[model samples]
Target chain A: MSGKYKDVAYYPGCALEGTGHAYNRSTKEVGKALGLKITELKNWNCCGAMEVKNVDPKLQTYLSARNLSIAEEMGYKTVMAPCNGCYHNLKKAEYDLAHDQNSREVTDRLSRKAGHKTYEAGKVETIHALDWIKEEIGEEGLKARVKNSLNGLKIANYYGCMYTRPRHIFPEKDQGPGSESTSKPHFMDDLLAAAGAENVDYPLKTACCGGAHTLSDSDTSTKLVLNLLTTAEACGADVIATECPTCHTGLEMHQARAEKVFGRKTKVKILYFTQLLGMALGLSARKVGVQENFSDSMDLLRERGLY
Target chain B: MPIHEKSLIRPENLVTHEHLEIEGVDVSGHWSTFINTRAVSDYNEQMQEEIAALPGGEYIHRCWQCGSCTNACTVNAINPDFNPRYWIYLIRMGYESELLRDKDIIWQCVSCNKCTYACPRDVFPEGVMKATAHWLELKGHTEKKPSMVFDETFSEQVFATGKIEDGRVLREFFARTKQSLFQDWLIAMVRSLLMRLPVTLMMKLGLATVFHPRTRGWSKAQAAIDEYVHEREAAARKALRLDVQGAE
Candidate 1:
């Protein structure tokens, strides 16, 4: 742990504990391989995810604010959330707390009623896992540390929706030269490329996987995910590298759903970027919880001699 | 090609003549095409204000009809009829009857925010989509969508406990929506996952369903959010002109 983000607070949210368990496992494995320390936020609650926002946007704001308040109480200046939904909500809450007076009033009232320290804007800065890795360990550093490089692994880097959309919530992005672009995010690409993986020229990198309505509107999700899968295959990508749990799970489930119901089968494998990075750092596939994924990539990985 | 430019032209609106001669002009076959004149009445003047009263629809007045939202919408790409721009236009113009034509599919916005990102006027088209879906359910134009049911189910758990268990949310949503818990694809997915999962991990996951994870000392926060939700729901009902018993 020798970099700027050697140690930071980790808030996995609820998804990581269940459907996104693989992402949580691989993220920590990759962090260990890179000699970074991640401390979990103390007794954090839900960030209200996408569902609670539809109920009431202010309640969602307060939910995320409660987690940030916990982070601030632990004397941490920076907190890292790997789930895009969690990261986006935290950033949105931070923005609303700073700009919207009504949001401030609601969060203040809720915090007082909840008997927790009210979280003021700027008390803690939220960073995504992409930002944490890209900033803490530069691409050059990753190149130097690769024990078993991801050679011959062609990947289509998928950033999905929440990572960069409705740009007002994320003020840190789109800063001139090396910052992440909202239209064309490249943090995952940069990190994977540094690991010696061949990134395809994927145009739908920022496309939606329709994670929000995967169950409510299954056909639409299947069609949208079919587009992503077929497009990735057309781009000659064997694997679609994902950074968000919801997108990863959506792609995996819809891949199966497309086959089961729609009779349209696509053979593109889905794996989290952290899992791929962990394997590149010489961690075994089993070590990164690859088998725990709904999308089985073990055969392809074994054929490529990665594990 | 993005479906906004020509989406207003419906198949029923087009009239074609198989064999016709208009003043010896021989206007027949493909050339004999005329769009029926449309007269839109029964405008609900309070439609825009009602939607604006929702939580995410505060910026509906900022739209300037640039069509950026439709061009960048995710669902619009899959199904052209899911046009945010046209819906926003109808909402602003108080064409409630015309809006009701596509009421069934309006709840499928997916919340991708591509529309919000592309909007130059900062209208927050994503929020507007949610508000419209909400308005549809509140005003009784359509039955409650699966998305709404899922949101309500998920939110109820969040309000009860500060945290949500995914298993519980899934079960309750399926039960409430009258969907079976054992769909073939879901079973297959779970089977495949269990095939690879270790024994310890399986036990942990199984126990989670029983224990049901929750946040400590969450009663106060739950009470506060419950009160706030009740107040907001009342306000929304008032805006939509619904009575205390939910009758309009």
Candidate 2:
């Protein structure tokens, strides 16, 4: 392994501090277990999740540029974001600043007015949490470090829409075998497999959960999430491991909504991939903030003898 | 010859006669279906340019109607009426009256970007959907959708404070949208979490709602963003010719 990602700046965004507390907690726990260091960018602002882009795409670019500037100011060349939305936006900001002149001009104006150094492209590289672990600690490393293996826990790794859509933002992916594939993302699957989980051949890995309008259009979100849940179950997956907090909560909330509103009940439990990895590393369920998750998977963990 | 893809023809345009003889031939029932021909004269020639002026619609001109966007659309799979390809075609053709037929559902595009990933022509149909939805609202064809309201509520928090508290955003959204906060599934989800959550974490979450998260020294950035947004809003209005009409 390159060991380049041993220490990096972390940007959790707003969702992690609120609805995605479990993902935030589990990610840090996994990092600690892996002996990697993630320093939180000091006084970081929001990355303008899916909502702000609707207001103005340029504004969203500015928001992410500000965060990248903070990372650069902290003397870090690589910043890791666990949230797919944060990661995507940061990568998007980096791409736009490099390719689009208008984007660079607007970001420069906003930074000048915001009283911070403008974040030029190539100042800092942004990597997702999956890349942080996969590149630094590969499957072999993880296998060697496994304390309590996942032990054949059937998992469907759900990457969701933002992680690999409109593919221009992530230039590093799809560069052959070792690099991540935008079409069929296997970083999560590989990591969970290294933890001894059985990676199911799930087809809807990159499906949209209608997360952008999850609350605004509940029925659509419910339908989309139900499809993911049923497909995972059809693939014989007992758990749907998610990397994005939005997708994790969307699956949980819509799983409930589908049952209540549409009368379609699904039993596949959703957990953050980090939580699974942390548990595999012998961290207790409580240590990874399992109690904070909307879906109660304690019984499932117990049944799998993972606790 | 019968029109191709008869399912796409509007019901009002499809005419069928049960018992009729046309030109001495017994063309009755299933054989007597004819599509009504009509002229579309109310084409808003400015529609394409207006939408193109919006952020996402900039690439509308690049579309060659490959139908990859519709085939890859997540919303279109669930709701057949949510067709980005057809909408792009209508927008390019300036079929304003035809486009108005699906204005209500345009905002349901969900911003999936599957269309973008699948498009070979770089159409970015997902952005076109957003721009069309925005155009519909700006031109007073439809009211501000719940999605727009939620976007505004979530964004206003970020624009004002550098961060947003999930609880406040939810509460304000429900209040603004007039949706009851006591949604069954929401309550059930909350109850499940409460049952499992530690009291310390629960208290921490409760405190976050009271004292919402804010980035330190964010007022300058907020001011800069607000200024940029106001300027862009004015430009959008000017582009849509809304300012001349004194429209909001």
Candidate 3:
């Protein structure tokens, strides 16, 4: 593993501070356990998630660019975002600023008016939590650090939509063997497998949980998330490990919605990959914020003697 | 030219003779089913251009009738009526009336980007979906959808303050949509979380609701974004020709 990402800027975004607090907690805990350094982006604003783009895509671009400019000012070459929405938006802003003249113009104008340094494309590279872990601490490194290996845990790693969709934004992925594949992402799976978990062949790995409209259009989000949960169960997965906070929350919210509204009960647990990895590295469930998850995996973790 | 697909044709336009001979050829029942021909004269000549003028719809002219967007569509997979390819075809053809038939469901697009990923022509069907939804509301073809209401609520917070508290966004969205926040599933979700969440964490989340998180020195950025949004909104209204009508 390269030492380039040992210490990098972190952008937790809005979700991390709110509904995805567990993800934030576990991510930081896992980093600490792995001996990796993390420096949070100071006074960062929202990355617009999936909402701002609906109002106007350029506004969304400028919003993310603001965060990238902060990273540049902080002197970090690499910025790691734990939330897929934040990660995708930053990557998209980078792509648009570099490729589209109009995007660059609008962003520069907004930056000038907003009284911040305009974020030029290629100034700072943005990476997802999966890439941060997979690249920084390779699977071999994870295997060596596992104190309580996830030996018997059956996991279905759910990459969700934003991580690898509209593949154009992510130029680094899909480059032959060692690089991540956009169509069939395996960074989370690779990391978990190294932690001794059995990775299932979950087909809906990159499927949309309808996270964008999770609250607005509840029924569709419910159906989409139900499909993910049921498929994970069908694949014999005890837990659906997620890297995106939106997908994680969507899966958990819609799991309950499906049972109440559709009367279709599913038993698969939803856990952040960081939480799972944190536990494998000997962090207690409490330390990884496992209890903060909406899905109660205490019984399963207890039965598997994970803690 | 109107599409002649069996599913695209309205049932009312399908004519069939139960037991009759056409020109003495014994054409009856299923064999005699004929699609009633109707002249389409209400085409909104500017429909395609209007949609293209909106953000994300810029590449609408590049589509070549490919079904890849529809094939890879996440919404279309669940509900066959949510077809991006068909919608693009209608918009390009200026088939305004036909497009209106599916106006309500268009906003239900999850913005999943599967269509964008699969579109061979770089039409960015996902963006086209968002643009069409906006166009529908701007033209008053449909009421503000729940998704649009959610977007406005979420964006307003971002524009006002550089950050948003999730609890506030959720509460405001439900209130604007006239939904009771005490839904069974939502209550169950919160209850499950409260069962194990530490008191400190709960206090932190509760405090965030009272004191909404804001980016320090964000007023300048907020003002800039507001100006840009107003400009975009006015441009969209003009493109849809709604400005001339004095309708919102």
Candidate 4:
């Protein structure tokens, strides 16, 4: 294995175990197909996932810090999370621990009480799956490895909130060349383009799916997801390439909700970028867990000869 | 504090008389508008400080009234009444009554962070919205919002098990919110999934529901989190001047 992200610590968080099972399966399958290694974080807990912060931001920090601490304990400097919520929380915890003394003290106190070593900032670096694929194997590497190209598929790469927001949390992004942009992310686009798919110009690429209130405020989530779906369809995207599980499920759920409740039916398919990349890498739909997804793209896949 | 004059153009504050002559000039229709005047005195002096005391609302004091937050807000795009800039202005000026006008929609911020991203003052307006929502609920201005209920439900599971099963959380949230499990769209979504799902994978998922996934040796962490949550809740209640029972 390459000494880089070929073998990094993986933190799937809670979503992957349930609704985001497709993402979990596709991410692993793509990693395996590309000859990368993923060492799952040993007994990793939730990374707070946008809900704990409402109760207490410091507690959310502690929750993510515990996961980072485990990676540190396991001797891996880089811990990778595929879920935007997990990735954002880990990065936010790292930032808060370094900059805010209160957060540090609270995390330390909680760690001591929990009988585990406190996670110090700078002990480990948090990266998203986008960075894992982009940095480890560039577009050139990806292009060379594509066995079954996505010849006619059109994609709208959607990078939801939490991946890049509040700006300060993601310090590494927005740097000059070779770094991801917070305002207009293109890593997913770049990766998909290399796999022989056409990417449409989607304005709402960084729009919120209202994943935070998917269940809490169903109507609001439906509206937000409806806008994303219709906008993607308008952009001539056959599929919305997603990097976050919450976003994937949010779109899928709300698409149905919009049709059933709001009477606003949209035809844009939603699939994880890994699932798309996995298919481009010659893996079957079932192999990448497409059936596990709430949004069925089987007919589309078969029509495009991808299934 | 300077008296806040009711705007002459405001529909609620304006009074119009039809078919009446003003000074015998026959200014009877459009020119007959007059604003109702009132002295502004009832202000919650501790409103800003109380909101600032909440976790996400800490940096609200840094705001300079730039409309960037509202302009870039996600909810604002849909509902014109959901204005963050106006709400922040009200909070900072201790215009409690004015803020209450939109108390119900404050919790609908969606945490999009567009406000945070657009704010040049680093006010973290997204956090301020959450804090304001919490403040509204604590002050008895509004009930616990569905979003807060969802957050508590999701957090409780995480604190208890060090993990959460989305299906269980969804079921519990729907139950708490008095929503039916068999919504048409939800059933349609499930039907689509079930059609393509393999039997073995379905079996595995069923077994997962039976034996919920949990982190091993998570008891100590769970205990620590529960204690921290309890202390945090008490502290938050204290900040909002609520009793231990969350009553003011």
Candidate 5:
């Protein structure tokens, strides 16, 4: 709108505020480089996620609306969420407030608790931070930051189901519309493309990597992980990449289970968006928070001759 | 090098929210309280929901059921038998056993929030979906949700050294899980009998191992972590500057 978001509105949600801080960290860095400013939403709270909105869809709508409405009143029109979950919740609130009168009424009631603030649903544009970065930075801009590129990379663009699905919040086209969909218009894919990655056709791009299920149902989660690795292996992908911390955990942490299932040694690795981004930018592993991973990305890089 | 020929098949239903009823999955009642409330008194109530869910989720009230969650869900996208939308809906009703029983599907939420993104209602279904997994784990449900397994070790690692010692965390996690990675297995087996620890202990416990690495100045790191966490908490409070009329 202003050429670039000189002052971008940021919502880290609760998880990103805490353990999932790395996403926020990477996003801020990348956004800043692209001339998009990242400003923390004042008095922002959790989206009541990790709880079932299906239990009380109204409450989910209400709380999420209240947060966004607050942002609207603060004069912020663009809501940037690093967490796909947050992005969905915030965007959904906006959409609900727009179409459902009941939701608006309830949101108004919730606004009472805001100590005297009101929210209008459509007052903001909610998008994953990645979407805007690609728009602003473009391939040329990203190429400028390239001190290094992923050469000879057998990189897999593991969308992990979040990047392209739930097309309501994201542009419908981003989902690569139609049943015969192959490569999604996934921003992560674009990001990988910018990094000079050769995207392997990963079937589990939208497949569940066994999120919290890994904790509640290890055997099941293990199977899910097993499937993911097997799928990536089938695609001949040397490494997998993603944007969410939870997704990262599911794919990497479940490696042991995968090994147990196949009864063979496994060597696949999982990484955060920044880890791969850093590699593509010719940055060192530590700069992209590589040491924090369970499986080393270096080994994969070396094996692929990308290092 | 493999050539990844881009498919002409369009990705039409990516997390497309279609109303679904996963038969055989049992749970009666709808989770409408979180959404119907209209308004919360303040931010803490909202955060309370997130923290309580912890390792699982913070976006409990975000689902508007476009089937985007189910559609985008890795498990569902791959295996419709495991639907996140249905699992989360069950959670909305506080259907504990229903969620616990699937044990596998409940843990299968994959934390991507594609459903959350597409709901058109911003109902981060993934948060509560994950939280349900945590709730299952807290209740001593043996089902190991992918992210929840890290919860205990992540917390313990934090408490033990004020910072995460990845090596220790990983080793501790495997030990607790009963999976012995070579040497770590032998140590866990020996420790298992030596401690006379009950089987319930093994419920969260696993085979022991020294596979995880530890830091040299863990005590300093621990203190720093505690101090930082406290400071962050204090800062949050300072930011809220709460105007409480009644401290019930």
Candidate 6:
């Protein structure tokens, strides 16, 4: 890799492995173009995500630590995650290892409960994908290579929670120097700007798009989604862009309820940042998984001759 | 114009105009790129690769905007706009301006664990919100009214002395908030004479401070603590960047 990043170890957590595969595929395609080699980790398992904690708080961190331990065993120092759930879990494990000694003890107990080894203090570094683009690629280089540029694309940047909330527990510094050090502060924003897209900051950027809420309370989830969509639409966003697969599914697929519940209507296209970046990179619609989304992002793609 | 009556834009008009904020500076207009946004697509491949390298970013590609987290949150009941689901989606999409303006809602979370509990896929939406809030806490202190007022003085005091004495913190807070001098004086006098003198006299008379050893080498202790935190933060940042870069 001629760019700043030489090689990378890619960890596509469970969500991406099964449901969120589009992110994995598109990311690989895009990464290759950027002069980075993505090597998938072997025997990578579920991140023990945020759910197990509620079900069994005792086993929670241990389950997450197992994933980290796997990375440590593989001799991988750094791992990247596409799902906010995976990011949060991995980040939490890292946080526990660093500051909370009790957390280590708890996870160690779980390690014995599950019969897995205890994760050492400061075992491995876990992070979201956004920080990588800003730190390694460097804005100037990334922007310099833009091909099609999705300029004039009125976009709403969706954060979907796990990337940048609860500062005390966050794993990384956000928005430092030219680097957007923090989480979800536009892992795609910088790329969008580099690609010539008009990224509009909607007040609802941090607004929950109701990722997991759909299962337990569909209507409430729908209400939250509608409010965010309504606010984003009000902000003049023609398209809503996001990183989390669950958030993407919620925001785009649920537009009908969002329209009905809020008594508001919008034709705002919702697409993954990868899809948008693929558009910018001049990838054909099919190659970038445009049809995968419920929204007719194809229309947006076709309008730009991206299809 | 007849006697002017401000007409609030109805829901119907929201589609025609949209509000956008950059660096906390909000603006609204017809959904059009005010700046030459042509830079967006030029390097998607490179950024895509960079984004791809992060471990969890793979799901970013799968994100379909299902409103699960917003519905899962108890905090959203109080403020209808606190959406973790949307924020992560935006971050994956590279919307920096939206994230910057998001400092308001990031703080609304009570961390009740409902959203995390409700998430079907175990997408811990709260973690990223915390990360973003931490990001803001660093520089966002200058932007936030509450943090700006006294976070600095409080931190300086704590950094100088290991713990925050409530009296000291409150006094600095009151000063920063610009409370009237007489009001503060009255409260301070009442509290000091009524609640504090006994405690203070005991300490002064060496009855209370039996174990309160004078914090000798406090600066050295402070430096060591600061250095350790800085190192941990640095390590975390390094790992985060590595993950981000490699995922692509």
Pairs with backbone N, CA or C atoms under 3 Å apart (clashes), candidate 3: none
- On the 0 to 100 scale, the lDDT of residue A135 in model 4 is 90
Q: Per-residue CA lDDT of candidate 2, range A41-140, in tens?
A: 9999888899898888999999999999999999999999999999999999999999999999999999999999999999999999999999999999
lDDT accuracy of residue B110 in candidate 5:
56
Residues A34-142 of candidate 1: C-alpha lDDT, one tens digit per residue: 9989999988899988999998999999999999999999988999999999999999999999999999999999999999988999999999999999999979989
Better of 2 and 4 by lDDT: 2
Q: Which ten residues in a row have the lowest lDDT in candidate 5 chain B?
A: B32-41
Candidate 5 docking quality: incorrect, acceptable, medium or high? incorrect
Report the lDDT of model 2 for residue A69. 92
lDDT of 4 by residue, B110-168 (tens): 99889999999999898899999988988789999999999989988888888998888
TM-score of chain A of each: 0.99, 0.99, 0.99, 0.98, 0.86, 0.89
Candidate 6: DockQ? 0.01
lDDT of each: 0.90, 0.92, 0.92, 0.90, 0.56, 0.57
In model 1, the runs with Cα more than 4 Å from the true position are B1-37, B245-248
Binned by DockQ into CAPRI classes (incorrect, acceptable, medium, high), candidate 1 is: medium
The digit string of per-residue lDDT tens for model 5 on A1-307 reads 3255556688776555433544556666656545677778765555645333422344556556656765677788777777766676776676677787866765665455434456775578776766666655666777778767876466676655544555554443534332213234466777777777888877667766656444445666677777778778788887787776667656665675455454644566777666677566665565554544545566666665444
Using Cα atoms, each model's DockQ against the true complex is 0.74, 0.81, 0.82, 0.79, 0.10, 0.01
Interface C-alpha RMSD per candidate, 1 decimal: 0.8, 0.8, 0.8, 1.0, 12.5, 21.3
Candidate no. 4 TM-score? 0.95
How many angstroms is the interface RMSD of candidate 5?
Answer: 12.5
Best by DockQ: 3
lDDT tens digits by residue: candidate 3, A1-307: 8998999999999999998999999999999988889999999999898899998999999999999999999999999999999999999999999999999999999999999999999999998888899999999999999999998699999998899988999999999998999999999989999999999999999999999889988999999999899889999999999998899999999999999999999999999999999999999999999999999999999999885
Model 4 Cα lDDT, one tens digit per residue, A101-211: 999999999899888999999999999999999899889999899999999599999999989997999999999898899999999999999999999999998999999
Model 3 Cα displacement at A208 (Å)? 0.9
